[model samples]
Target: MPTLPISLVIITYNEAGHIARCLDSVPFAAEKIVVDSGSTDDTVAIATRHGAKVVQQPWLGFGPQRNFATTQATHDWILVLDADEYLSPELAAELERRLPTVMAGAAAVGILRRSTYYMGAPMRWYRPMVGERMARLYHRGRARWADVRVHESLRWEGSTVDFAAPFHHLHNPTLVHKQLKVLRYAELKCRDWLEKGKPVRMWQLPLVFIAAFLKDYLLRLAFLDGWRGFAVAHTAATYAAYKRLRYFEMRRNPDSVALAQAELIRYRLER
Candidate 1:
């Protein structure tokens, strides 16, 4: 059978520094659709300069943005990518050689997204690597990102493969951004937990934090990456702690009327 020509899709938002590097890897994709969520930076220009079609849209969260990117594509088989991620050379060659044969039965392709993290100075003692095998390439209608706002998985409906090649994900270049991103994720996660009626015991904070720390930093072998590992371990624990703390804040009902006004003001400022 002839090979399945594919389209590579990417979602971007203020990713000026990384978009060009991302689009650089798959120049031969039959089509490349970049769904942007109002990037004030040159992300759109960079993608367009690379011969990709850039579609600007509102911030609709992660899963929906990705799904919208799929809708704008011109082909059934899609190679979904994050603007901060890029295909490694080994994966690219393997995908070009074998992807077509496996395209039909496979609803998605699993690729390990190797993350790189840094501190104020690229922490030699605590670098956390991306430990995820995400479903990227798939049939047009076979899968979509789940509705959950944080750590959402692909809603897939068929067989998958443990693709050996890794996808490079340059997560956070500095400690400030890293901490900020995790906190944002923590807020979303707390909302998810609250929606599900999850308990908000103060004790649950340390327990969940420690457990998540162990799973990612130790069990997932995130420590193998050295400094990046320690940072990840620490961040995972911090995020859990923050989420549980927020949950308690709402549960216990902080009765300071003045603070309530301040909270609303802060919320408006952040948004």
Candidate 2:
């Protein structure tokens, strides 16, 4: 059997902490490409040392950045991965066995289940069915990421295959990091909503939050995971509510928006 060639593509900024582990996990890759967006840390150096071709570009939005990285790959088959994610041993073996078949078949995209971990432990019962699966492997010419700022997905017209082994995602390393991530995502969501002229009704704020909590905690069976499940559900609900509330506040009070913008600028400068 002939080996299937694949290019591993990743986009990063200040991801020196996980770059080594991520690169180490995919030793079978024919080429490793890291498209960095001006990392202040040793991300570039780490990737280069790991035998990856590193390219620097300014921060494009998430979808654009991923698409840009795909363009740099020399192989036809590309596996897009986040800096905080890595292939499990089982997954790597599965890929090695399955890629040849997939390449010969008509499938243009490959989907895999991703098991997310919070603070070093897996969130086993959180939205098990819906949030776990993603399309990360695809032929570069057959698929492209949507042009959205947050929650972007791939657009593919061909058939897709689902791999059995799951990818390990180190979602949040700590509670503090989780909180910051939720807030930053909320901010970007609010900005995107405002740009798209999406109207937020102040009256729907509480209702939306309640619905989000119920959907995740009850319907999604987050409670089955214990305290971490509850925390995940609550944080997701809070993120949804906060983004809407922030958008409303910004639209209603320009003075508050100005102050918030100034504070953000000051914080960035200080950092």
Candidate 3:
């Protein structure tokens, strides 16, 4: 196999169901590294068996963990993928064909991420809800992950080009999984806001939820997908509301911070 001068870096917890498929999809990676924050499931063993160098580290916030993973890579060019996301065959082939030019000049490459919901339908129009174009493939020297708890992204000053194809996101396999994910993300975002001393705008909670729903369903054209669109848009709006609610709770009752931290740790260890 002709490999690109790129290293694939993935961060995982209890992703036994998705890790192997993600690893197998990127044969063009010159190196593959999985940084696991103590998965009680078979994530570590499975990743190691699939030709990834597994590194066991305690959980840091998302951005820091990803930046740490980049340090473990053998190549300066980095390809970041979540445990549940994998490159499509067309996307992978496109990367192999264009990456050399990308590495020579571009700061990073952004690819469209098409997600599959719990009901198993691949969404055609959820871009506004999730910012479908993501800067996943980049050079470590030119771009790095932002230091945020939730919604961490790549930060770079140079120009980024978009790829023609999209990668697949096997998002939230079940209802329970989706619920837990929202809660976990809400808590993390709450903590980030608290640390920054940002006050919760009480009036914006309901307004934000409404805006998120309309953005997803109407502006993004998710309504074209019928019930599936409604469900995903509702979920996005719920997440927006829950995140603010979590912030208000933690800010008003400082004592709850300890409980929230414990819950987060438990979720990471057990999930």
Candidate 4:
């Protein structure tokens, strides 16, 4: 059986530790494109060694950067994967099987379930709500990423279908790493809020945190995973609270935007 031709597009910055594994997992791809922001690491070299065409571009936020990468692909059928994510063998085979149907216009997008690992183990109860299922496989001409920084998603008018298996996401390898990830994401969220002129509801701050905790812990069944679950739930709640607090602080201070910009600069430099 002949395999379907597709381009695998990935965006990276300082992902030296995981890029090779990510590229290796997608041996079926006809072409691999990696759009990288400036990295003072071995990310670009490793990706090139793994047969990915590496393009150097400065950070343009999540959605915009992904859109730029898609344009550089040789094929219309594109599969976007993060540096820390890779397809399971089952999922890879499923993609090879389904690509023909997708190219025939049966569906405009293919959704895949992602199972996230924390500290080298799968998180049984604390699955992130945003990435449960993602439309990572799509025809570039028919879809585009929404213009959001933290949790951008694909926008398409056609039908979609789910893949048979899940992709593996090695996200949080350590507690400190997890915290830093949350902080960075929260900072981006706060910036988005400020950009949209969204006002912070100072009065509902406590309630917002409480609701986040309950939803993740009780409603999402994070408790079933034991101490790790609790930690995930607590961290999620704290992220929500921190974003709100950051937004409020920005709203109150006259020099907040400058401060935020400085912090983002520092973040990019450190990474």
Best candidate according to TM-score: 4
C-alpha lDDT score of every prediction, in listed order: 0.71, 0.84, 0.83, 0.85
TM-score of each: 0.82, 0.92, 0.93, 0.94
For model 2 the TM-score comes to 0.92
Worst 10 residues of 4 by lDDT: 262-271
Q: After superposition, how far is residue 251 of candidate 1 from its true place, in Å?
A: 4.0
Q: Residue by residue across 1-271, what tens digits does model 2's lDDT show?
A: 2335899999988899999999888888889999998888999999999989999888667888888888899998999899999999999999988888897777889999898887568776777633488999999888999877667799998999999888888887888877776766666667678778897698998999999999999999999988888888898899888988889987887577557657764654211
Better of 1 and 3 by lDDT: 3
lDDT of 1 by residue, 1-271 (tens): 1234788898777889999888877755778789887777899888999989988877566666677777898888888877878888887777877776776564455444454434432223233344455777777677787777668667877677667777677767777777767756666666567668887678676688889889878777768767667667878888878877877775576453235436644643112
Clashes of 1: 9
Error of 3 at 77 (Å): 0.4
Q: How does candidate 4 score on lDDT?
A: 0.85
- Show the colliding residue pairs in model 1: 115-130, 125-227, 126-227, 126-228, 126-231, 127-227, 127-228, 127-229, 128-228
Clashes of each: 9, 0, 0, 0
- List where candidate 1 sits over 4 angstroms from the true fold: 1-4, 104-131, 222-226, 252-271
